[model samples]
Target chain A: MEDVEAQTHLIGDSGEDPIISKIALAEVQRAIDSLPQEQREVLALVCGEDLTYREAAEVLNVPIGTVMSRLARARRRLVEMTAAA
Target chain B: MSELHLTDEILMAFADGELDQPVAAAVARVMAQDPAVARKIVEFQQSRRLTRSVFANNLAPDVPSELRAAISAKIEAYEAAVEGGEGKQAKETKSIWGGGMSPVRMALAASLAAVAVSAAYFIGQHSQSEVGRLAQLEHPRVLQELSRLESGRDAELPFGRLRVISTYRLPDNSLCREFRLQSTSTSTDAVACRTDGWRVTFALSDPAKGAEYVPSSGGDLLESYLDNLGAGNPLEGEAEAKALSETAR
Candidate 1:
């Protein structure tokens, strides 16, 4: 699990209530689980594993451009899903 | 120029630190005037953080027991092969030594062999001058560092620090260890699999160029190599530890 302090820092929010943070975490988890397997894998490697695009490409055996496109699509989907929720 | 059109690819690349400076600067300038684009970028960043938080566990999953067993078997097989080869070679050499020679002649022969071995070692080191200085080190150093990592000890060489990322058996059943070497300005990823000893099958380096150049992560390349070799999934934390411990023993 990610450090709550780091997550707050990334989102640039300090005054967020603990209750709201918990709800947001649940929403984010649900949105991610809803992603297709390929997109989820891309997101996991690029964001979670912290790999460079070139590195992700090499790992997945796809082109770097493909990794970029998949990541873009994945992020867009997550944003849309979270907003809908 | 027409209104700056920022494609999702460009925006994502900018957010991910994958874009070169001038292009990223242009994107930033455009986003300054467009709230929609700026919001999209923010969304991407937020999603990245969320995804990272959610999937952080994937990187260090528990190793399956079957994989651990496979590794142990592979190590035993490699050791057997090495012993068999050495036994045959030693027998031939022993016969040669036993074939009677005067004591003085035997002493002279031993001296010549020593000089020849030293000359060969120096020549081998010299031949690797075109490679990085770290790559020129004796093979024993690599084995020693690998052993240290197996035993959960810190190992460092003159050129850089070594990190054993993963260990697995290749499709051909060769035991392989993937490691990363981080130096002051360069990072090298290499895969060394056992034959007679650990032989480097793949190595790639990313030397620092300028302030903007980020070192490419070695894990991806190592994973890709494993994929191509049809090496199954990497041994997880416990499996890796068990395999390393067994090999060390």
Candidate 2:
């Protein structure tokens, strides 16, 4: 019975307007959390900070190309994870 | 060049406007001719938008160092509390979050697939295997069928055979399917709703082992759960198909 109530509560949440937005945000965060730490860090620096590849490389103390490749992989993985979910 | 293979890095760089003008122009020309290439660019752009939207608040000083510092500070504080004592653990921490979250905590704050997680906790409280039965109902095979299985049809799932009884909406208009699962040992009558996924909202197993659940038509657990659910009319034909398609996600 309690389980039924909890399930009802979750289902009720699914119908509200934030269902899509909040659920998508959750999906994205979960996807990001599953990324490799290096990929996650690179993603944070690039997308979260709006940093250019070169600037991000300078901050991370890596070559500019490393930033590009990592960001590419991270972006691709995000697409795959979100779509699969 | 007449043709250039576009790698993800090249497309991403093009999307970010980080490529040289000549290269960017070339990529644009190619994208104009190739829908696949253009779609990749859009995806890269969308991925950037999504990451920024969710992660912007988590980054302090808009740097990776802030995340690293927060993680380390939390770990050190936890360790100090374990070793030195609670008194010294209250010392000033460098995390911009004050008491920063662990990665697990961060993800928890974002979202948890609560059904499965809580099922584990409920296992201890509930006698003998009820939660296990509930958790087992979440198999992809079950959901795949739930999204398409109609009343006249039956599905042979990995764990059991399934028969969908009806399709309807809850008070809040969440799509739901009532189904019965008959394994070799026991039969389950359950209501599944499309939320984050097709989750079983409530279930009652028959004590009649190896027999399909016997319906009383009244005063049963299944009936009781539905009593106040404010169920809408049972969907059928195109409507049922449309509702199930939404649950496919």
Candidate 3:
């Protein structure tokens, strides 16, 4: 029952009030903590620090494609998690 | 319409300001009316703001001398390694190639399809010189996803910058802990295990931006740990604040 509710919460579409926003942020952070090392690092470079994808690629010293692919997977996972949470 | 099929990646890019002007404007139009898309955008924006706000305080203090000294030592070592002779040029060339055949050339190499796919692709790789284990611990799938789109807090987190910046404990009383993670380029979630369950605290701060985290003693970590620990209700206000201040400082 709790799991089902949690699943429903993940896909919720309500606008976030400040109180809800705080909970969502906490959930997001928790989601981030769960990612693969490389994926987490890339997410941080692009999302956390406000770097251009190109700049992030340069920083990580990996191919831009790798960055993109990893990011895609990472984002997909987040969306799923968000939907679930 | 098939032509208007926008992926979540593009929507996220638009939210993150990774879109070029024209592309961003195009997505903005779609988002204005699409409630689902709009919510995702709002979530992204809010998360970004909170991350910035949380870590912004760490920048207030001067770079601890210890951190600066350590980075300097590494830099000098790097210089010495390069100056040490014949092997230097090879290493430099390798780093450049490793950095990827130059971004300018790569951009020019792209086809139209590739250009269209730009926002969805484009992740930054780790530097070859980075040492230590790329330790990505296990987490619930939902939290795992958030790690991807979110980067570290600051600009250029210098290397080897760790300090026992704060501590926190949970009301559940499973555990209390303090950590000294690096101020730059390090994002980790730590959980001090409790008997009823584990009370975890995660930090995502970048020294480059001078971001300092506001201790979330009973915030997400306590609840999360409890969830994982398979016991009890979450912590609230006074206890939460007390646990955070007690452990983080």
Candidate 3's residue-wise lDDT over B120-183, tens digit each?
1111112231113123211232122222111222222233322222223333354333233342
Docking class of 1: incorrect
Tens digits of lDDT, candidate 2, B163-248: 88889876657877888888997777777777677866555555322111112321243453453344546788888888887776
lDDT minimum window of 10 residues, candidate 3 chain B: B116-125
DockQ of 3: 0.06
Comparing 2 with 3 on lDDT, the higher-scoring candidate is 2
Off by over 4 Å in 2: A1-18, B59-249
Each prediction's total of clashing residue pairs, residues at least 3 apart in sequence or on different chains, is 0, 0, 37
Report every candidate's CA lDDT.
0.53, 0.58, 0.38
TM-score against truth, every candidate: 0.41, 0.40, 0.35
lDDT of 1 by residue, B1-249 (tens): 556568998877766656665566466444534556666666666676566555542322223455434433433444365467732112111111112311111110112111111111112222243144335322577676664475233468776677777778665566677777667866666666665556555554552121111122334434544554456777767776776566565
How good is chain A of candidate 1, measured by TM-score?
0.81
Per-candidate chain B TM: 0.40, 0.44, 0.24
lDDT of 1 by residue, A29-52 (tens): 777677676676667556654555
Model-by-model DockQ, in order: 0.18, 0.19, 0.06
- Which of 1 and 2 is the better model by TM-score? 1
Which candidate number maximizes lDDT?
2
Ranking by lDDT: 2, 1, 3
